[model samples]
Target: MLKLTDMTLHYGHSQILNGISMEARQGEVTCVMGTNGVGKTSLMKAISGTHPRSGGKLELNGEQLGVLPAHRMAWKGVAYVPQGREIFPLLTVRENLETGFSCLPVSEHFVPDEVFDLFPVLKQMQNRRGGDLSGGQQQQLAIARALITKPNLLLLDEPTEGIQPNIIQQIGEVIRHLRTTSRMAIVLVEQYFDFAYDLADRLVVLRRGEVMIKGTRDNLTRDQVLQAVSV
Candidate 1:
């Protein structure tokens, strides 16, 4: 549902992404695997409109990005769960989720039940401050907040980072469930090969901001993916 063709991005004078090309299909997870500092996050930033692309094209369901800012992208069915799970430390969970309402009409400002079903802890901690939650809970809160927008393209960056093993398993299950139950396309950036391999229908590996390897699960093995991602 999302496609990036020869995409490139720059930070001031330093170019971070180099002709990166990949695609994420509806009802599937396209995991971007790479070592640290390989521009995986930069690629995501380019797609999500947080950092605009310097060159190439970004199209969602054949619709090219046309001068859309980050808020505008969120309004156009793109929801991003950033690497650090940037939840508002001071806001209550409910209030934090309400922030997503900025992009929605008044009639669609409420959180969906599916978010509670996906992470019950978020519902339970509705009135608690986001900063008080543990790392795993914070991750769940971040994902929950993103879902409040009802997006079609979900961009998740390093979801398993710093999360507990059990929470990681839960997150993986949630990702798989979303792929099967919802039509939303997912772009996952994960350094955890085992987790990404298990859930990824397609894998895209990056090195120095370039596509090093990419294919479907039926064509690539865990070892091959692992080797490609190794620094």
Candidate 2:
């Protein structure tokens, strides 16, 4: 559902992603794993238009995409749950979710029941301030807000980072359920090896902003991926 060819990104002048190329197909979890500062998060931002790529082609669902901003990308069916969760601390949980409605028609402004079904805690705390929630709850809120958009491509940057073990497992189960639906392509930027490995259909390892190793789960061994990311 998403493709990047020789993609590059820069913060002023220092390039973070160097000629990176990869594809994320519908109904598949394409896990991008690497050590810190390897541009895993930067790649996610580039794909989701939170940060525009400096060079190369970006195509989503077959159409070539230009350097559009984040909201525009959302309109194009891309949802990004960034590394920090980035929830509005001052806003209520419901209000935070309502923000996603900006990209949708007014008729579809309401949150889906399935969203609550996915994270029942959110439904219970709809009126709670975002900052008041625990880290794990906020993470769930971040993912839930993204799902509100009904995106074709979901860009998740480190959904497990700093989350509790139980919450991490819940997030994994949600990812698994999403994959089973064959609804959208998932590009997960993750550091937790076991969590990522268990859910990844395809693995794309990045080293210093370029793809170091990439293949299906059947083609790449666990030790190979672990070594590549560790190095």
Candidate 3:
């Protein structure tokens, strides 16, 4: 459903992504795993249009998408749950979710009932300020807000980064359910090996912005995925 062909990016004279090429298919999770400074998040920024690529082809369902700003990409069905879970501190939980309404028409402005179904805690705290929530709750809110956009392509960067174990399990189940029930393509940038491996139908290993290993779970051994990010 999404493809990045021969993508390369640079910040100033320093190159980050090197001829990166990958794809994410509907009802499947395509995971990007790597050591730090390997441009995993940078690749995401390029695809999500948070940052433009210097060279390469990016296509969404065969429609060519030139490098545009993040909001433009959002309008085109690319929903990004960035690394830091950047929810507005002062905004109430409902307000934060409402922010996604900008990308929708007036008729679809309200948050979907499914969002509350996915996150019951969020529904309970609709009137509470965002800053009052715990990190795990905040993460759930972030993902819920992204889902509010009804994206065709979901770009999740470290959804389990600092989450508690129980919450991590809940998030995992949510990811799995999304893949099973929806026709959306997911590009997950994750360092937690087990978490990524569990949901990943396919994996792409990045080293210094280049793909070192790319394979389906059955084709790649678990030790190798662990070793690739052990640096």
What are the lDDT figures for the candidates, one per model?
0.91, 0.95, 0.93
As a whole number from 0 to 100, the lDDT of residue 139 in candidate 3 is 96
Q: What is the lDDT of residue 128 in candidate 3?
A: 94
Clashing pairs in 1: none
In terms of lDDT, the best-performing candidate is: 2
**Which candidate has the highest TM-score of all?**
2
Q: How far is candidate 2 from the true structure (C-alpha RMSD, Å)?
A: 0.8
lDDT by residue (15-95, candidate 3, tens digit) is 999999998999999999998889999999999999889999999987998889999999999999999999998999999
Error of 2 at 175 (Å): 0.5
Clashes of 2: 0
lDDT of 2 by residue, 59-175 (tens): 999999899998899999999999889999999999999999988999999999989999999999999999999999999999999999999999999998899999999999999
Per-structure clash totals for the candidates: 0, 0, 0
Sum up the clashes in candidate 3. 0
- Kindly report which residue stretches of model 3 are placed more than 4 angstroms away from their true locations once superposed: none
Q: Deviation in angstroms for 34 in model 2?
A: 0.6
Reference-based TM-score of each model = 0.97, 0.98, 0.98
Candidate 2 TM-score, true structure as reference: 0.98
Ranking by TM-score: 2, 3, 1
Which lDDT tens digits does candidate 1 get at residues 35-134?
A: 9999999988898999888999888988987646798899889999999999999999999989988878899989988889999998999999999999
